[model samples]
Target chain A: MPIKSMYVTYSDSIYQFIYFLVGDDELAKDLTQETFLKAINSNPQFRGESSEKTWLSKIARNLVYDHFRRKRLLKFIPFLHEHEQIDYTYSPEQWLEAKNEQYELYEALGKLPHHYREAIVLRKIEQFSIKESAQILGWNEAKVKNATERGMKKMNELLGGERDA
Target chain B: MLDSKLRSLERKTLDEETKNSQLLKLNKRNKDYMKKQKFTYSVTLVLFGLLLFVFSQTITESPKSIQSQQLTNFELGEVTKAYYLYSKRADRMYNLTSPFYTDKIFTTDPAVLNEFELLFKNSEWLPFNGDLTKYTTSINYLFQLENGESVYLKEINEDGFFVNPNTMMQTKLAQQSHEQFVFYWMHIYMGKNEFPPWKIGLLTILLLIFVYAAIKSNKRGTIEKNSSLINLSGLGLAFFCIHKMNEWLGVNHLLTLLLIFTFFMSATVYLHILIKKQEPNWKYHIQRIFMANIVLFVLFI
Candidate 1:
């Protein structure tokens, strides 16, 4: 498929995956752009081992991991961004009933370890099959099953419910 | 709530305008990255070549010759003439020949030259018809007099050659001659006896600027290959400078070992930086490990 068509097809899924992985809209947008840019530049040889969605998700996941590595390194030198203020302006009044619940679910998702968060987001929210999630994560199917089960249990605890609905 | 909300969000997509703009930005960045890589590769090749030239010249040139010119071989004959003139020789000896001393001046001391002239007047210059295989630091010249036993001439520095009258006098004569050679090449170049504050300050400032630029460029998510290669060559040059300094200071074996260990530690860190920018494939892992070992081996040598 042409890159533009693929971007059109997959950009939302990719962005939402990154947004939940890291709880920031601007960062998710940046990483989404970076992910597509990497795909365009690398011209990866798609051997049909996984679907294009799985491939793009894998790229977006790697980009997010790279971003987190950089952030961890920056944390050592706090003085570098001393003047930059973090925005925390999301008021409860602005969020509708469903948006507020989704927001709380993501807040809990962001607290999970990267593997657990990725497994939960891919399986529960994105609703990818276990085999597909394993293909995207470059993991075996068994590991995906374990991470998803454990991740969903933890998410339930954090949300104070057995199920979201 | 989760399944319904996810279904509602699933319909969301970037608008056409935002998608087009992001594509445009990606294209621009890709072009810029390619241009930067081309520039970096060219600069790295040029800098590596220049460093190689400088390294070769440093090995060839005397440490003191940068500050003051040493007399050439043709001019060394002047010292011979001065020696004969001072000795008031009725007839100049034409057969006073040295094997490696053909053009290179052995000594500038008038007294030693006169003594050689006097010795030459009485004896025929038996050419040291021995092996003339020249080495970096010293040359051994062996000649036999017509009546006297053979004398071995060993030339070390510009003014530190010794004419041993016989095999028994070789060690003793060379020691005395070395003490009186009157040359301090190391002290002249490295300035161990004096410190130049301005030079040190200027060098430090330039180093700081180079490091700052490298760090800033690296943080922008582009690891220019040229900068890394330049750093690799710079590390080599640092190793060379430290070796020369060690020679100058008459450093002991233990200190040399310590300095070498520190250099290897730094080189390992630098190798890690070079490898970190590469793709994490099996080929990359093998290449990274291979290159690191090669770097450490080269530096150790």
Candidate 2:
């Protein structure tokens, strides 16, 4: 498919995926833009090895990892941490108005390690199948299943025993 | 269940206008990337062309001193002249055609002629400054050997050609007429004229500055993902080192060129992979490809 069509089809999912990974909306948008730019320039062939969404998710995941790496590097500076806070338009009031359970889940998700958070976001929130998540994460299906199970259990523990039915 | 709540939370998080605007921004970024890629490829091709041109020129003929026709056409009285030409059959030695002969003599051996042609193929006139005071008024036909040695064809005044010419003149002629002179002159010329130590030192300083800036910027996390300036500088340093190695080993012109071209092509491929796997930064990779080619041209040719 042409790059323009792919952008129209997958930009939101890619953006939302990045948003969940980084916990910042503007940065997510920037990374998503970078991801699609990389994809279009690479012009990867779709050989049906995995779905287009999985391929794009993999690219988006790698970009987020790069962002994390840069952040980790910058964390060494003492003053930089004081000045650098995650910038996003979402406010606590807006999250509460949307759904209290969802807001609590977002907070709980942010407390998880990157891998677990990614697993939960893809397998549960993004609704990717275990096999599809494995493809996107470059892992075997068993690993995806295990990570998702552990991630959900951790989320339950972090949310203070409120089981959202 | 938790899954249904997650599903409901994910739904309609972004409006149509936001998604469309995001796509528009992405489209602009892609266009910018393509433009950068196209520009890089063009620069690389141009550098390759320049390298090929210089490589061909270097091997075809060595640069010679420009000669004047005034001396060649002048007639001197009762002056016997002899042409010294290289002889390959005689173990690549200079054999003088008997001094009794007054006409010009040409050698049939290309290897022998090539050696002489490089040093004395062209000529220039220099004022006579030698101890021979009588010839001070006349101009000397000067041919500069690649090693910076000067050969002068001086006219005999009252005395015809001396019983034995100056040993320096004979040595100069013999050196120019030897096949070994080709390699010897090339080494001296390449070492002294092509790559001077001062120039290499300057390039080294420039490379260090580039590396330092890259490291500092990368550490601060202020570097843009698509920035290639550091990579281009690194490639330039690599080319300089390679060219220096070639000069030290005295590699043949054609082989040196082939090696440089191969190194550059491989580097280009590696950088291309980096660009594809990471951000779409084409400027530096392309600049590297182009700069390496141009450096090889300046170094070898």
Candidate 3:
């Protein structure tokens, strides 16, 4: 694919990845735009050491880390409005009836610990291969697989497995 | 059965509804980001060009001398000789005005000492005149006042004060006079010379450049890259101190001391910034110490 078309095609997937990490629609949109702008303006010698998708994902992840660092989130966890109690469980029929599961999924992702949330976003939402996720995240493949498994198990515990529909 | 069902749900593909919404959002955001980046880059370019123009103009201008040739004549010889002799005796103080009398006194020829002396005596100046015997060899007159203050006046030929060619005193004196004139003019008259003002302006321009670079990096979401601006600011500050020290102390003992201290402090702070990888809080402390030193030096001057 030409570089421009490839960028356009992958842009929304990158946005979904950032949305999964931040759990705020506006902020995720902003970060996603920033991620692609950076990728396009960067020196063209990307050399494919990893897939373009993985490289862009790494840039998105770094931007998310920077946002949290600036917000000093670790120092003010209790004050985070996004972490307030929410109704996670849903009857199967009710889940089918809701118009937007994406927002719900995003909020639940935000409440997860950083490592687990990152693993799930890469593995489940981005649907990156386990090896690609590990490379982008600077983790071993075993660690990536373990974190994804643990993150999904924790998600089951949070939502109580009622909305598999 | 539950695990298989969960797997199937997780594997669901992106429907047209979600894909279209994501594309619309991405397109709007990308446009906004590109516009912001372009605006920032243009502003930076214009500022950089303006600074360069100002600095270049400053460097190309001529330097003006501060010493007056009118003060070097034989008619003013007596007053000038007395001033220099007094200054030398007073631990090299730079002020040439009389400590005894507030006004200047003029005399054309120094050979007629009694004429000058009689003029003072008729004014009822009752201060000590050591003896008249010294006046016979060279025209010497003791200008004495009732307040017990005296200045020994001497005659000079057409030849003026002899200055040694190899002495550093002449160079330092010239620099000191220029600096004094520049400082006085800047503070009292809102005027500035090309050299000092240019140097100060250039350093300020460099500081702004680094700050802009940092902001650009921040906008691009690169915080670590922005740290380079902090380092650049630190270096610019060190150069500023060197420039100020050159003006204040000249190229002499005091200047040497300032140079060594400035280098040592700047290097130490640079190392700290690079090694610790923390926000350079120590740079502010170092700047405070340097400022205190400048205050003390200026007070002495």
Q: What does candidate 3's lDDT look like per residue over B1-301, in tens digits?
A: 2234333333222345655665565566656655765576567558746854654343333322223223221121122122212111121212323232211222223343333333323221112223322323232222342344444443222121112111101111233433442343234222221346665576567557656764654333323343555666656565555444534333243335645665776676576557543323332345445544544443443
**Candidate number with greatest lDDT:** 2
**Of candidates 3 and 2, the better by DockQ:** 2
Q: What share of the true interface contacts does each candidate keep?
A: 0.14, 0.31, 0.01
Pairs clashing in candidate 3? none
Tens digit of per-residue lDDT, candidate 1, span B37-90: 556656754874685465434333332111212322111121332211111110
TM-scores for chain A over all candidates: 0.79, 0.82, 0.75
Worst 10 residues of 2 chain B by lDDT: B85-94
Rank ordering of all candidates by lDDT, starting from the highest? 2, 1, 3
Q: Candidate 3 at residue A53, lDDT? A: 83
Model 2: clashing residue pairs?
Answer: B66-B123, B67-B123
Off by over 4 Å in 2: A22-31, A34-104, A110-116, A127-150, A160-165, B1-9, B61-233, B241-301
lDDT score of residue B121 within candidate 1: 34
How is the predicted docking of candidate 3 categorized under the CAPRI scheme? incorrect
lDDT of 2 at A128: 94
For model 2, residues B169-203, the per-residue Cα lDDT tens digits are: 21133333333533443444444446567776777
Q: For model 3, what is the error of residue A108's alpha carbon versus the real structure, in angstroms, after optimal superposition?
A: 12
